[model samples]
Target: MTPTHPKASLLTRLARLVRMGSHIAHGFFILAVRYPHLANAERAVITRAWARKMLSIFGVEVRISGDNPGFYPPNTLLVANHVSWLDIIALSSGTVSRFVAKKEISDWPIVGTMAKNGGTLFIDRSNRRDASRINGQLADALSQGGCMSVFPEGTTSDGFGLLPFKASLFESALLAKSRVQPVAIRYLDAHGQQTGTLSYVGDHSFGLILKRLLSMKKLVVELHYGQSLQAGEGELASRFAISNAARREILAGLNLSDDTPDTARQTLACPQAVTQ
Candidate 1:
């Protein structure tokens, strides 16, 4: 397997950072203001284009494979294994959907503001009641022909294995009868070998991860979309089964065994964090 890229020159990293900041500013100040007036289809087009540009600014290329549901069908719940903070950007390049993220993410700096404006649904994991409220909102959105993406793993991984899925969120899919599309995401080097160049796990500061990402020569994000799963009529038991099945599909897409441990397959070559 090919190794990760050596750090880019300081000047190159600075330039890329500047471009990304400018792009984000444009989205924040310009596009966000006009988003409310755009139709759903128009919003999707703009969202996809902006997401592609964002990744391009970071010098990351996204390669989509498997049952690629172009732009994702309406009322679909796109489930995926979490790998990096950049996972949203990679997936958004091919499909447009509001994301379900933790309440803490909505409190982050620019990212939080952007996410809120981009129609993300933030759930307060510490509050059990907040989950039910979010589920109601999800069902309402999906019933209104909206698409959403949720990472059932609930945390970032090292792109080698997956965490067990939280079945509670799948309840929204059943409520709306939304199709669950399992997507497997990976951060790889130019040669297509998996790399932890972008894993945003543990206590690594966001700024530190950003700098490492900026320094990488080439980062490839692969999204392997599995077949759409029908939620069918279900109670708690059915939701649990569906969640497990989704995890299985994602693991298969990552070419990992169902019993694969959460340990990293290869050492992450970037800055390491001592704790989450």
Candidate 2:
């Protein structure tokens, strides 16, 4: 079910107006660069505010589950599932965290600009050398108490299911000895159908989605936070275990049965005992 507002023309106008306002706000970041001391925290604040505004303009509402823990030690790494591009806006609006995304996203038109301006880390998945370089950079960022959000499921999917999480990226958590928080995001349509429009799978065009969103009256997003896991004795084991637990938490939150007959649902061995 789509939005049923009679004032389609009015909403369209409002959406464009809001987009203009966002561009203006985006420009303010250039001004922020002059003041080094205020850049970091201010950018975070501005990014969050912009995310909130964008969601508001798109008529999407966010509902969060579990404890919204404040960034502790300022070096926490959040691992979550990727749904649609909208997931970025939803999560950013709720947390002042930076994202770790694929290198291709860095070349997208307006999105590329926003991701770069928002301080997102882009990784080249096709090149092992490049991936290694990014891993090192991520380690350094976490060592310095910088928080980052990563989607362990290398790609996005419809909100109904999860993909196999790539364990390689989890190496950064071990390197920095940082806490890994599992997060789940679900998107729904106005009539409560799990439209999964949030997932950018198949041949769906970003421009087409953006136009549809402009006409949409309401969208619902759910964010579920799970227990944080610590790096264990072995990197591979630790990553596998954490990713499995995260998959379970996300599936449970969606009210789906855990007995689904899919390879992705298989559990892995736990490297170390989880505190939660």
Candidate 3:
């Protein structure tokens, strides 16, 4: 028997697809032409609008908790647990920010072009040197007062728990003297239970994931923003320390134990804990 939530009908899904196509075209135009001339405020508005529209088309809702910081402060670095490709879209819906993503994404069909124009930095994982270059670029971006984000896990996992955060990118925040915002993201069903219907793990293709998401009965993305970490002096300011601290805040926000059994290839979780 099916759950209480009703899945999207074929007609509704079709309508959504049509609208998404149009929205993508509009985004391309804005990024290719208008974005170059738009002021930062205007660009943030466009980015938020575009992302919200994309989520709306996929029938996803966003629930935010904690002291909502509203717009991202300049020279801020947002670090979050990566669950799926949708994480990027969900975060973008909140504010205008650049992301450090896998280099392969830069080659994905239409989305690749949009990501490039939208200021996403792509890192080639196979090359160790790529991380240094990305860190340098991230420092430069943060120095210029541009808000940047990265999935410090260096890969995606099921939302049940977080992978150990890689410390490489945290150096950028320290170098730029930017505040680090630790955000815990969770995908839930109508009943508020965590769901893996949105996890983009394993060998899933983009088209396959999109189709699954579009057919979902209900989706709610919870973003728990922890207290922003200050760039303090001494031991606390080291990249390793900052990374661990950020991970701890995210773990608290997720209500997960330090030794939570690994079900990352299996399930999802949404801890009611608040860390604002």
Candidate 4:
């Protein structure tokens, strides 16, 4: 009830901060040490619990709808719109899945090390050849019953809109013949108005974002898990078609307008088109 309790006592704020720091430290230790030796199932259990603790510390609640991946094919791929780094935290809270992140993220301070330990696959979009490499690796993982997710939008967007998805990641599903699940993530305030505080886009530096997040009273994210399907589930799907289907489903779930411009085009990579 941070919103109603605006004058949060110094002790209360300090408590939240200490708890958040402790959770993050504990998570880092697990990722850096113990998790690496655990079986896939054990890693999933520990990571999911750690993520939920982190979410609770941040005072961010995730409300899930549609088909929770927790109950679906374990080897499926999850595709979703990217809003902020927090998206990963929210998703991890729902279920555990390896993430497909940008190569830059793999070098981002503690986050980078943590991502590597959490089994993230880093994509260097500039190198087309790397796509095939990742595809092969992803196929191997999928065949072994691993679930992976990518923000096919190729970039993050404000909560009110969505960018088209880039099609490359779908190659994994094609190679593994796995189901692709489209998800939409949106941040809302206490009164249910769209909140952009969680967006890690534009000129927002990491430090600025951290400050804003810490200052905010509460954050609510809605996770809409849309339909999941394989290339030949209904109509045969080309990679482009699959990518489009994922984006379209996410757009619908967030109730975002299709015509929303690519606001991040100048700064973020504007892929040819949005596709699975």
Task: Tell me the number of clashing residue pairs for each predicted model.
Answer: 2, 2, 0, 4
Superposed Cα deviation of residue 250, candidate 1 (Å): 0.2
* Superior candidate under lDDT, 1 versus 4: 1
What is candidate 1's CA lDDT for residue 94? 83
Say which prediction, candidate 1 or candidate 4, comes out ahead on TM-score. 1
Report the lDDT tens digits of candidate 3 across residue range 120-184.
Answer: 88887778778888889999999998898887776667788888778888888888998888899
> How well does candidate 1 score on lDDT at residue 253?
93
Clashing pairs in 3: none
What does candidate 4 score in Cα RMSD to the true structure?
4.0
* TM value for model 4: 0.88
Q: Candidate 4 — which pairs collide? A: 165-274, 243-275, 243-276, 244-275
Query: Which stretches in model 2 have alpha-carbon errors above 4 Å?
Result: 1-39, 71-73, 108-110, 233-237, 261-276
In model 4, state the lDDT of residue 220: 80
Model 4: CA > 4 A from native: 1-11, 260-262, 265-276
lDDT of each: 0.78, 0.65, 0.78, 0.74
**Candidate 2 on 36-147: residue-level lDDT in tens?**
4555667667667777777876778888887575533366777777766677778777766777766776677665665676567887666766656766777788888777
Q: Whose lDDT is higher: candidate 3's or candidate 4's?
A: 3
